[model samples]
Target: MTSTSTAPGAAAGPDAPRPAHRETLRTHHGDTVTDPFEWLRDKEDPQVIAHLEAENAYADARTAHLAGLREELVQEFVGHTQETDLSVPVRRGDWWYITRTTAGDDYPAFTRVAESPELPRGAGGVPAIEPGELLPGEQMLLDAQAAAKDAEFFSLGGLAPSPEHDLLAHAVDLAGDERFTIVVTDLTTGTVIDESVTGTGYGLAFSADQQWIFYARVDDAWRQHQIWRHRIGGDPSADELVLEEPDERFTVWFERSRDGKALVLQSSSTTTAEAWILDLADPTAAPRPAGGRRDGVDYTVEWAGDRLLVVHNDGVEGFALAEAPLDAADSSAWTPLLSAGEGERLLGVESFAGCVALELRAGGLAAVRVIPRRADGSLDVEAAWDVDHGGELDVVELDTNPAWDSPALRYQLTSLLTPATVAQVDVASGERTVLRLTPVPGYDPELYREQRLWATAEDGTAVPISLVARKDVPVDGTAPGYLYGYGSYEVSIDPSFVPTRLSLLDRGLVVAIAHVRGGGEMGRDWYEQGKILAKKNSFFDFVAAAAHLVDQGLVAPDRLSAEGRSAGGLLMGAVANLAPERFRAIIAGVPFVDALTTILDPSLPLTVGEWEEWGNPLESEEVYRYMKEYTPYANVRPVEYPAIFASTSLNDTRVFFVEPAKWVARLRETVTSDQAERPILFRCEMVAGHGGRSGRYRKWEQRADELAWLLDQLGATARV
Candidate 1:
């Protein structure tokens, strides 16, 4: 965009491609906001599309020299990874389903084997699994490579099999848009049943009879407001609407009950929740609400035999476990089974034939409690893991507990330095078995180390930080480091090994994660303290983390880089405005930098739904003022910024591409001219959305480009 700011050392780059600008004014609550780059909002406009193409050309010219390095990074990552890999099989109904990714295929192949004898214990007290090959009578369920053959961008959504195992209803997203088309097939005959049903959400379930499908239908705002029932062989236009949520902020989705006897419609917003149950035996009846909606309280329901297991945060700040008769007439009948302790947060509960499992988090760690009876009876269970600092991860989660009659619960454990390990535990005996360990061909865990560190926030609050590095990288303030953070939506960024990260570790660089207030790592309280009016705690905590690393002599002032995606990108932009000199470079992927403007507009996709997480500024003048004070685009000034790279997807329905497009435009117009060599690069994927390109190989190349760019800025050469 063509705009001028003539403060000391502030002007556009000599070769920067400037997009044409048109003046636009927006007013909210008597406040005037000017946006010159608003013309770039419409992707369909020829001029708007040309500007993005020009921006891409400029970015290509700048990073063209790193082409060789990008290829090398891609090769190094591929070498470390097990090209031909098989996922740990899960028992479902009468078969054990598995997915495999070959060396050159863009997608995985889903297959299943006939029910066999129970796996016997091996030498190491683990279930025996043939890691490389399938057993006899293996049948192909769905080949993703074949499904994606016709589309430039293909993403698989729901893949649900009928209770009788004769029909499969799978969802496919051919465009980067989140909406999917579900195709029903007769598994026995291996043929498509009829025309595909389009505009369906990811959550789709089949009736036990295998004649109908229940799915969530997304509205124009990308919200799942209606749940529909579609007949497999009938016209999708004749699909019945089972429920329509009146509250726009709340979304509705359906899932078949454990016994496949009913369909559950779960609806929730940022702070409240409600559930409805539909009897599958009588498809003509409407679903009835489980209980009256309670404000500021959230809960979920699961059926075990004739009892309804409920996990709610009604009376307890964290959460508590309760139960009711399947046909309970009143909410008061919810019998409190267990209450969380001072620091424990009862996350959720999973029901099975023999036992019920509880997922809990405390002191920034995660664990799962397996109760043999109908309930655990108490909040505390003896099935806790003692975390090992050097070798093991602190988080142990309940993973793949699919069968209603399973005798064992499958869980996973991982850390910053360790690859994921899938384990199984007997419900009755509580004896744990290690099932599989993902193989990374050329990497050694012993050569690297990971640790949890704490940093003090301004209010004396301690923030958790996860760090990993090569043993040779000394804390002498000479090595380069990359710090990452995402503290919104109560979404915890836990530690999981990434093979691509080896390129940084072997190159003598340190990687760290700042577990700040907005994340659910600690508990509900931690998340509460970081959102709404307390949202700034996230950005401040991140700054404190960077300062803590420097004070600990782990990285130099000029060698430290930063990264954040989505809301974390909002954090990156805010901190950059608040303290620009603290970081040397930053990469924000699909960032939400235009926070204040987005929140004030109610018609946008997620604005109204997100008002609970981020308060509505349009109705409150105080909130509008506060949001204005910290909003990144609103606070752009003439200053020397860190080397910046912002990425966006044209079809990203979550955070619109216009946000980052406007942000990079403003930065190029306002930032110091002396920093011209420090590129403020912007890259937009013309045919992708929030998750980016679909294929694994495409994703790897994209990652290589990003890592190479950051590595070049850090002055750290890749050793491999």
Candidate 2:
């Protein structure tokens, strides 16, 4: 899609539907290049679905003049959301569950409620799910707006229930790809006992004697390689498989062990892992492994009490906490317990039957600690603590404890102007509580104000960012910022709260988040100096956090704006080709902008397991010239960039949608900008995936049509 001079949302005029180039050469190591929009990567090309429906009808006739500022940013994201809410229920043993949400249901119903000795257990044994009656024996599990009323892209994936909760299972999907479809039901004869599993891939468990069910399938490069089992009235062609992961770089699944007595199973990759276990009181046994695979060793197990915690990075690289012995067999008999500290990073390890939470990441946010359990039940890791969460750039975490003999714990906190809460500490007298806070309606965390700034990069390194705004705006230099980013797997983009970002902080804009260098925020050596050949230090720490927010005048060197998604949309296409005049609009979502033609094609779908996070440029030539030096569709040049947009989806499956449809057809044939005042747009989505259109008011009308075109390119559309 690259030649145009008109025919896109054509009212027969203002041009821009360029789709004609068909060059395609792609050699490698000895460098052969020439890829003119690689035939828009043929999605069964009917002229590549008519050039992605004529670039979504030229991005709906160029934002059809921002449809009333995208319906006032979807009614200011439904007037700061809280529409008939519910959540905080949790329990999971004698039932409790909850989920609710009804005001204009785009999905959310899943009820439960049964542990009755007639109510009363509030604060931590958590019973009070009040509002509008029905508690006595409640029930109705799964309405998901009546299973997404005949799906047009629902998603759920794994729900699972049956530990005598009388069966349920769930799964579904409906074509936002990640294949699903399990079903099962029978919660006390509501019937449908097993839709015979179908494809499957987002985890599910149910075996502690409900007779089998496991799941996790994928492959054909959609990875999650095998696992299976089935049987509860089975015959999805007599299921069974149980573990296949023949290393196309790992990726398996499993779950069930917060004392449901063993399931774990894992596998993983992007730098090694392995874990198995199974047992569930022998529901046809056979999972076993707990350790073995090694490479750069990574671990994961859980079950605490009679041991088996794990969490590893084998001889430590910012992860540690061992334990083993539940019929041990690996890491040469584990043991340690916590160790790995210096600049922290831990990340996960839950356990409960009184305590053992963890989850860490230091110097750069996220906390949640706990330890308790030592009257002889074990894990007093030097009596651990930290759960305060009284903001130090708040993030907190460790949520839904699912009753592993509930000594409470729960967690969650938040930041970027609070509104998230969900407390409940007490891992033996820490005594917190809160339980539910998220109601935002007209949010006013004292009219916002968050900070933690920093920046530096180009090898000097520093980074950080975060920001948030509207504490009476005025960050001199005329505000209007926006920022956001993602860096890459070492994930960590924390600070939560989003009632549609209070419609970009009540419109004065600002916002922020960089935390760059392949983010796990300052931890595993800040993700080993930003990955493979120091992946251009995540585009020079996102163009040095946009030149330290426009040289500290705090944004507005032309109203800023930026964003990311999917590997932070490959760090927003390498900072829009490394600083395309410091943005005035960017976006990128589901991007991964043709990273060296999808990592030099190892037959695509997750390109050879993302060669441990983008490196094996098909047998290195210094990883194919270090991924063709910042592969944003081979570094599009002709400058003058900004105002881009890009979005993708048409069933994404991990950054596909032809890499933002050949990077908006090679920036509409190599940028030099001014295509009628900086327009690049391209959108796509048509029946979504890679997180786009999937109910919840179609994801708030696709985030109010991408924040009404990023509040009309950060001039901040209307509302004060």
Candidate 3:
């Protein structure tokens, strides 16, 4: 974890550590690939530790000239952000829940006020809760900053209150791993109870009467596959196991019904899903599936009034809405509430007292629609989002609506040039009430311009790209560009404002996101086209986006930098191998470069569960060959490469630190050293995990370092 920097102004010249080769042969499908740096995967070995530390030393030496720039970036970030801020208070049954952040603190403070019994709405069509407004007689419920004072890696996972508001159950993970410790606090006495469940997932739901709590537990392979229920005062070992899933692919998400009388859990994989319901009134009952689970079908269910409201794709191309009797939780007995359709994708649903909110995406843009419930217990779908629409890169989804009987539907909306704003829509009149807009000091949204562009892929597919830059920066291919992409797991990087990007924009760097086929940006079809045997589509799409940006005169090829993290890191690696000349530099954080090697072994963490997403390489020779062809570690060549900055954490559970460690080591040995002064830096966080450094200050420092490196590689002048 310790490293020495080179002399000042030495970044222009390189002095890097050359790791030794301990060749390891990996044979599969009657083929062998020699991995000379595979020995670096052994994290416990002192030799491996020394090599990682030496790489850290090399990175320190390589970026020595940017120390001043990094500091200046950090200071600029701090100036534009309000360190001390307050979130809009949400009112529950008997408490006004508020989250407050103090300057210089890594976490926020969760508090509550008891004076509010009946929630009040704004009269002039404004949000009732305003930022920084104080509620009388506030009580400190759980101060995360204070709780995380002693832990180096602290994650405030689940913060929930009992139905009666007397018991507060919160989970914390101190090791950067998602496995948390559920701690119960007696809110009546303002003290933490000794009862706690260790090694549990970050999910907690209290029963209607506050007698039982449902939480998820991670299996040996780090999958949350079990739901356990514990009595308020019972021992952790004596907790009841409500359900145990033997399937390794599906992960379980635990939740309580709006009425809090039943436990609702959804077990889902990448392409298929199923839901289970257990009446919390009877703690000894088994959970029953909401509907039959069919392969290639994904659906979720929720309780509203006397029936189960379902969002499924059984008969529709995109998805449809249906409802069934509470007892008959099967597809046959379900009646169509919103009929099947195309073009408009049914995202999700949330029920309130008077209406059901539908999150729908049309033409790849998201919006919230209100479907009011009639007196006869039916939904009005004519009021959907098809009425009027502005097809822009925007996000609209259901926000926190805890009260089952609330009259309004709360939602959050944001776009590329707009900060996030919380709003509540009146179900009847559709009047909007904006609660809060995130603050960015000394900044104006009008100063920037954002646009959505299409890039033509090799196969004639049009991939979407979201670009944002300062209006003053000329679009003449002379400005530096930062291109980002993550095309895996059907996870979409939606259009949202990022204040931190101002540092790059003001420095004349254009930021863009390549929404390739693997992401859910378009629809499920988009994801299917980029996974399994067709995974190469994602890599090719990214390459096309980079080329399109250059063709559009946005940035020169030699001035563009590409960056991605985790699975996105895999994207960066793939593109680096496919078209190294397109980018001047690449930043990979906790990258999954050794995909074929990891998937071939089932014993490693997350490998077995990832079979469906990346294909089971151990069983299928075709899958093995396909993965090996594009796997970054397997594809390193003798060609000249871009200046690379690879980072990984020792405790990363999802993407093991070994992947990046091995990739970096091999790149140093294989890639030609003719451009020796071109930096190929590796950074290892010894005490962190997949998410990198935990604290805000530490993460800011890391971001600044990355920006400094990026500016240096792009030949951009620092603001300082």
Best model number under TM-score: 3
**Candidate 3 residue 711 C-alpha distance from true site, Å:** 0.9
lDDT of each: 0.81, 0.80, 0.80
Indicate the worst ten consecutive residues by lDDT in candidate 2: 1-10
Candidate 1 structure quality by residue, lDDT tens digits, 1-720: 111122211223437667767988988888887788888878889988888888888778777767787888888888987888887777788777888888888899888876666554452333345645765678888999988886779998888888888888788888888889888878899899954589887798876666778888888888889988888888888999999987888988777777778787788897888887788877657887675588877888776657777888887878888888777633686888777777778888877787778888866777777666634433233443322223434677888877888778888887787688887887767777777878888888899999888999999999989899999898999888999999998888887787888888887788999998888888889999998889989989999999899899988888888999999999999988987888888999999999987888788887889888888897888788888888888887799888888998889999998898899889988988355557888898988879888898888998887887788777775572
The list of candidate 1 runs beyond 4 A from truth reads 1-14, 117-134, 374-392
Q: For model 1, state the Cα shift of residue 405 in Å.
A: 1.8
Question: Candidate 3: RMSD over Cα atoms?
Answer: 3.2
The positional error of residue 624 in candidate 3, measured at the CA in angstroms, is 0.9
Model 3 lDDT per residue over 1-720, tens place: 111234212355545667677788877879988877777778889988887888887788777777787888788788788888877677688667888877788888888776444445564232255445555577889888888887788887798998889989998888877788888899989877745688888689887777778889988788889889888778887998887777888888877777677777888887788887888777668888787688877888887767888888886777888888887666887788785356567778777768887777767667677788887867777755432225377777788888888777777778888788777777777777777877888778888899999999999999999999988888888888999999898778887888778888887888899998888788778888889899999999999999999999998877888999998998989998999889888999999999999888887877777888899988899999999899998898898888888998888889888898888767877788444445678899887878998878888999888878777777674541
Candidate 3 — which residues are off by over 4 angstroms?
A: 1-14, 115-134, 339-341, 386-391, 673-676
Q: Please give the distance, in angstroms, between residue 399's alpha carbon in candidate 3 and its true position after superposition.
A: 1.3
Residue 706, model 1: Cα distance from true site in angstroms: 0.6
lDDT of 2 by residue, 1-720 (tens): 011122211222246678887798867667888877788878887988898888888888887867776877787788788778888888788778888887888888888878777886676667876654557778888898887787788888878788888888888888888798888888888888777777778888888888788888887768888888888776778777878888787788878887788887888896788887878888676788878887988778786758888878876678888887898868899988777567888878888777788888777888877778777888778889888756768888888787778767788888888878898877778878887888887777887788888889877878988888877877688888888888777888877777788777777788888888777887877877788888789888878888898888887888888888888888888878888888878888888888877777777786888888878877889978887888787787887888787888888888788888888777877888766656787788767799888878889988888877777766677655
Q: List the residue pairs that clash in candidate 1.
A: none
